[model samples]
Target chain A: MTLLSALDYASVAVFALTGALVASRAQLDIVGFIFVACLTALGGGTLRDAILNRDMVFWVADPVMLAVAGSAAVTVFFSAHLLESRYRALLWLDACALAVAVPAGVGVAMGMGSAWPIVIVMGMITGCMGGLMRDVVCNEVPLVLKQGELYVTAAFAGAVAAVVAATFGLETGIALLICAAVTVTLRAGSLALGWRLPVYRARPPRNGPRN
Target chain B: MTLLSALDYASVAVFALTGALVASRAQLDIVGFIFVACLTALGGGTLRDAILNRDMVFWVADPVMLAVAGSAAVTVFFSAHLLESRYRALLWLDACALAVAVPAGVGVAMGMGSAWPIVIVMGMITGCMGGLMRDVVCNEVPLVLKQGELYVTAAFAGAVAAVVAATFGLETGIALLICAAVTVTLRAGSLALGWRLPVYRARPPRNGPRN
Candidate 1:
């Protein structure tokens, strides 16, 4: 497999595991576990392809991805109860998947000759949107939008790193590696070191309301 | 404007209204209202086009749809508090949007000469997915998936009505009209007459656990 495809598969497997863990927490049936796993594994890339108007979505072009996701769900369904802390496992696995997926998005958008803004947005979307959809569908607040989390910020920084690296005439492979490294570092820092962004604090109006 | 386009616009407006009302209930700011409204208005058609690999997503091809959703959001943001029962208004508006959207989906799929099953699924996706996304994003149980409601069932029956009408050599317009009529009737009945489907009832397993 091409390096990009390998990264895609890795991310899909990791994300599916996280999704199935979430399904377990929700007390869903086996079918629900499989559905959520596939959705989480494929949702981000499907959205990025749709926005870019790719001729076919990634999973549609390669049904093996579905098999990968389903296998992950089945494995998790029977095994999740053994984990003492599924939530912790989900966070770490999701960070790893983000590291892989950000580069995949950057590579695909760059290959498509997308503009820099679109490339950055696609990278973040690929890295974060699957988890967002998973949380929403399962009725949890999205980790991407939770107060003080560095999830989206990390994805953004990673995508910008790729763009900057490419602008400096780096090879595509080298740029993507840098992207993945930057993503994982920031995400790991947030998880392990409590790095965070300042959240909005509501305040009274600075001035009286206009008539 | 074509009949299909008109129906599409109508659905977008009504769906946006429901989305904005939901945003009010969520206590989000004006920007949040606009975001949710646009998401609810455009989400379903976007999903349909993406699945079909359409050359351009509907809103991307015609940017005016965004303006329509935005207008609806702004209007509701300013007036939602005046409603005696925002939830009731949301339900009725959502039902109206569903009626128009089902026909739009059937028309687009039929125009592409899709097979009957795809047409039916596309119709349901178009009619129901926007509201599902709206509810999910706003952290509410999805109305589409709620037990006993005729939401998805109504969309299915409507799409089947369209397919059946077309199989009898009816014109596209007539077929879509039948689709809309059936969808609205079922949805309205569910809303006003307490019509419902049988929901699953959990029962203790008769057979003992197997090794």
Candidate 2:
């Protein structure tokens, strides 16, 4: 298998694991676990494909991706309790998944001869949207929207790197490596250092008697 | 435009209004209103089209839908304060949107020569997913999954009716009318009568200490 394909499977597996961990937290059933996992693993790509008007959704075209995601969910369902620092593990696993997914999307968009803007947006969407969907379905605040760290920003930087590399006619493997490295470094640094964007702190006052 | 096309735009308008109401309650900016409104108006059809691998997203291909949705949101943003029973308006509006959307999706799927199962699923998804995504993004419990109504159940029944009618070689317009009638009857009846499904009241507790 090509290195890119290997990265795709690995990305799916880790993201699915993180999703199953959230399902376990919510005390959902096995079906819920699989649903959440698949959503986390494939939802971004589905949206990207839809926006790009692709002929087939990636997972629909390849059952192997779905199988990998489901297997990851099942494994995590049974084994999540074995870890003490499970939440931490889930976050780190998600970071790795994001790093891989950005390049996967960038590569695909470049292969399709899409514009640079589309390439960057698709890469960021692929990297961040899975977690966004997972958090939304789990009925939690989406981490990407939260004040915690520069999550989507990391994806943006990586995507920009990849897109610029493609514009310069660089090798796909080199572009992928550059993206993965930048994303991982920024994301991991944020986690370690508690870096965060400024949050909206003020709320609009409620209309009352207006007396 | 056909009757079906008119219903589609009407559905988008009402759903977008509800989405903007949610954004108003959340005290979000105008961008948030437009974002949520567009998502609510077009999310279901987007998902249906994606699953069927259609050539284009409905709203993306037809800028009219997005314009209608955005205009509805802008109107709601200015006028919601004049209404005392805004939530009630939102629910009734959602019911109407569901009625229109179920037939819209069923018609599209049948035109595509999809199987009965796909038609039914696409219909239901088209009817309910806009609200589902709206609620999820707004950080509210999705109404379709709530125990306080027969939301998705109504969509399912309508979809089934449409599919069964098509199997008998019914006219497309007739089949669509049947679907809208069933969905509106069931959904509106529940709202009028306070009908609700039995909710699961108990949660399975985690293993001791969950350690």
Candidate 3:
């Protein structure tokens, strides 16, 4: 398989695992588990292609990705009882998924001749949106918009590295490697170091008149 | 206000009301209510614009939508108890929001020079996706994916009508009005007549060997 295809496949697998872990924590049924796994695997690429106006969505054009994701989901569905872990491990797995997805997404966007800004944004979306959707579906706050670690920021940094490398005439292979490393390092580092962005307080509590 | 602006505002209000109703039913706290409300108001348009690769997603560009959506959310938060009687009425109001959003989304896509099929799909997405998001968030099955009365199909049909009208040299205003009527009529008819799509049953239950 081509290196890019390998990256894409790995990204899909990682994303599916992350999603399955999240669904397992929620004690979702088989259908729900499969639904989340597919969503996390395809959601970012779907959003990227749709935004780029690509001819067909990535998963719709390739059934194998769906098959792999489905198989992974099924495995998790039947084996969830054997994998009882805390939520923190799931968060780290989600971070790993982001690391895989961001660089792959940027590579795809760059391949499609997208502008750098769009590529960066698309990469971030591809890396982070599935988990965001997962959290929303699980009735939790989206991690991206929360006062958590630098999740999207890591994706953004990786995308920037990819874009810069491509612009500097680095070969696609080298660029992809650099970007993926950047994403993985930054995300893993943030997780290990407990890095966080400044919180935005939108609404201060209002003490209503002596209620 | 411009006609489009007025329609956008009205759509946001109606959509927020629908989300608030669902949030209340889900027994979510005030923050959850606001979150769902914001998603309902801007989620469809955001998806449409993102898919079309339009620069400056509507809510990201114009903060007024957020303001209106937030205000509606807070209002609903305070008045949720007073809205107990209007839950059923809000269902039709949700249908009305779809009637407005589908045509508006189509108009935006056509104006942006997308293909007819893409525009129609965007319209369907704009009309149906927010409610789908809300349902998924509340852990309920999405209405569009279920064997419920026609929802997305009605939006698609209305969008097609609008596109056809514009192709035939009709005024934009008249075309949008026709599309709105089509969507509302189709949805209301389905609701009243108990129309539904064929259920996607995988298979009938079969007797199995005892383990």
The best candidate by TM-score is: 1
Q: What is the lDDT of residue A141 in candidate 2?
A: 72
All DockQ scores: 0.08, 0.10, 0.08
How far does residue A154 in candidate 3 sit from its true spot (Å)? 1.4
Judged by DockQ cut-offs, the docking class of candidate 3 is incorrect
Model 2 interface DockQ = 0.10
Show model 2 residue runs off by greater than 4 Å. A1-39, A50-86, A114-121, A136-139, A145-150, A153-178, A185-211, B1-43, B46-96, B113-125, B133-141, B144-208
Task: Output the lDDT of residue B128, model 2.
Answer: 80
Give a tens-digit lDDT track for model 3, residues B1-211.
8656676777888898888767666555454555678778877888888767786667645667766876887776666555434456557878898998888787788778888899889889889988887777666677666566779878988998988998999987778888889999888888788776776655655776433
Worst 10 residues of 3 chain A by lDDT: A202-211
Error of 3 at A56 (Å): 2.9
Among the numbered candidates, top lDDT falls to 1
Q: After superposition, how far is residue A95 of candidate 1 from its true place, in Å?
A: 12
Native A-B contacts reproduced, model 3? 0.05
Off by over 4 Å in 3: A78-84, A202-211, B1-106, B109-211
TM-score of chain A of 2: 0.91
TM-score versus the correct structure, for each prediction:
0.62, 0.61, 0.57
B100: Cα error in model 2, Å: 4.4
By lDDT, the candidates rank as 1, 2, 3
Candidate 1 local lDDT, A1-211, one digit each (tens): 9888988999899999989999999999999999999999999998888888988899999999999999999999999989989999999999998999999998899998877866776798798889888998897777765556678778888999999999999998999999999999998998999987544222333443311
Q: What is the TM-score of candidate 2?
A: 0.61
